[model samples]
Target: MSFFAGNISYNTKLDFKTISNPAAFYLTNLEADLDKNKIVILDNSHAFAFKVPGDIFKTVKLPKDNWLSFSYSLNFRWDRSNTYWHSNFFLYLKRANRFFPVIEPILKKNGVPDDMKYLCVAESGFTHAVSPAGASGFWQFMKGTAENYGLKINEEVDERYHIQKSTEAACRYLKDLYKSYGSWALVAAAYNMGQGGLDKQLKVQKVNNYYDLMLNDETARYVFRILAIKIIFEHPRQYGFNFLPRQLYTRIPVDEIKVDTTITDLAGFALDMGINYKILRIFNPWIRQNQLTVNQDQPVILSVPKEGYREMEKLSGAFEYTLSADTTL
Candidate 1:
């Protein structure tokens, strides 16, 4: 009998009575075992499709002294099995299709490793989520840190919610962290727990390696969580996430409108642009309030749909623009 999947053809000679489930047999034969190490490349970048063995830490860019133990494997298994985590992971994957194009170029321009994009996934699930600790946006920069990285934050405009600017800031921040620690793993740890805290732990425990250091629960699981996410994202079908190309979220084309002056009434401005206020905010989440106050020295660029107001109308059905500015529609 011959069974075909993708580009591979399987020829098997076995009696049907020999197996309890022919479907299970074929599936078992078709999929590579998760225990085995195999190399998979995407966009010319190397990644392991399966778990990394103890012997080959360098393949995944782990430090030379690194060891892959049961703890790391357990974390990977835990995420793979957790339904809640899978749900979020699926959403993150879909959102990545929309956001990665905007983010990856900035990372490449800054010479940061492309894999660092997964850290953004671990941080915010590719959404502008505000953490309980007040860390906000895709890269999850706090108010002070966001400002320090050149992201403007105020009542009117918080550039932390701006995808391009925040990603650029993240590249700068990641490069700085890498310079300080000289290890991408340690840079990720510092990003999660703050450099000061990671530095304190390194000094107290007298360890330079992230894997070897004893740290807080969140910090300890941090890198492993990122790794688990990376593995699942790389091998989605193996982990049971199946999606057609059409099912994935896509980026919407936009036209940039530069405004050097303050808009006292954003709703009126949206009406002028032939889009609703809600649609305006949907594309430009960095605009915090109903009104955007722009400085002449620093112009704010807003994105409207490239297909014009019709695209915006498609996103949000036609509604009466008669609501008061303070109505909060």
Candidate 2:
């Protein structure tokens, strides 16, 4: 028998540095005797290593004694799809630098994991104005659903576009979903599909784990999309999405002006404040009409965009704001 198993003995040069960070380490002298064709042993210890291919180890053999039993906990329990993982991960990381801040508070307030924020990226692509299948806004609340979630929607105002209001409404809806499912993953999945749909599938499939169940392509990819987003969002720089301070979206400045009376013309009111009607709607999306006809005299707060536009206008003394002539119309 030639050197262990071969008909002929052959020696190969070993590059010690190439095996950096392998699961096992071999001494220089012992490495010379290591059989390249067979698995090597390592000194036994209760330690984990980032396994790398092709490295010799000095393994230790520990006696089986008093191994404590522990309860099984599920850290990440989902069937990972290769295709979704790659695509969604890239998208999540691409928008993560901007989307994270806006979504974090909603999760914190709702008692959901902050990781769920990536679902927003998967839903709206970090755009507040995305409209897919008639779903609207950053949270993608549909008209009927938005109304159900306590978001006001009408011809003049759509609160779905307001970040804080929409997020709060989304949290309320999510809390309800969680109360129904008791699992964040299931809640997220149900958020994509309705509670009725998810419940029907759960009963039909006779399984609860999201990954194991066969679903419609969109629903199947849903949880994977969320997980991929969580992965990339958690480690943005690891995936080559780095941005400078100035490149990210900054919060706009505005002052809240509460109105308890009728506004005959919002365009005029906006102009009186030295701003445009477009800017007025841009800041206060809750204002649903070009003219606020207050029949009930309920005080509605309007946020007027400040800083660059307002401050300059204030300095120039271009316009001044006054209460509408008719308090009720």
lDDT of 1: 0.71
Best by TM-score: 1
Give the TM-score (vs. native) of candidate 2. 0.63
Expressed as tens digits, the lDDT of each residue in 1-329 for candidate 2 is 00122132223333444533111212343234443443333444222221111211122111233112100101121223223244444443444444466677777977766656667767876555445466777788888899999888765567787777888888888889888877777888888887888999999999875645567877766765565444434333323233233333444556878788888899899889888776676565556568866555567778886757565434243222222221221
Q: Assess every candidate by TM-score.
A: 0.77, 0.63
lDDT: which candidate is best? 1
Q: RMSD in Å for candidate 2, one decimal? A: 16.4
The C-alpha lDDT values of all candidates are: 0.71, 0.56
Q: How far is 140's C-alpha from truth in model 2 (Å)? A: 1.2
**Model 2 residue 58 CA deviation in Å:** 26
In angstroms, the error of model 1 at 196 is 0.9
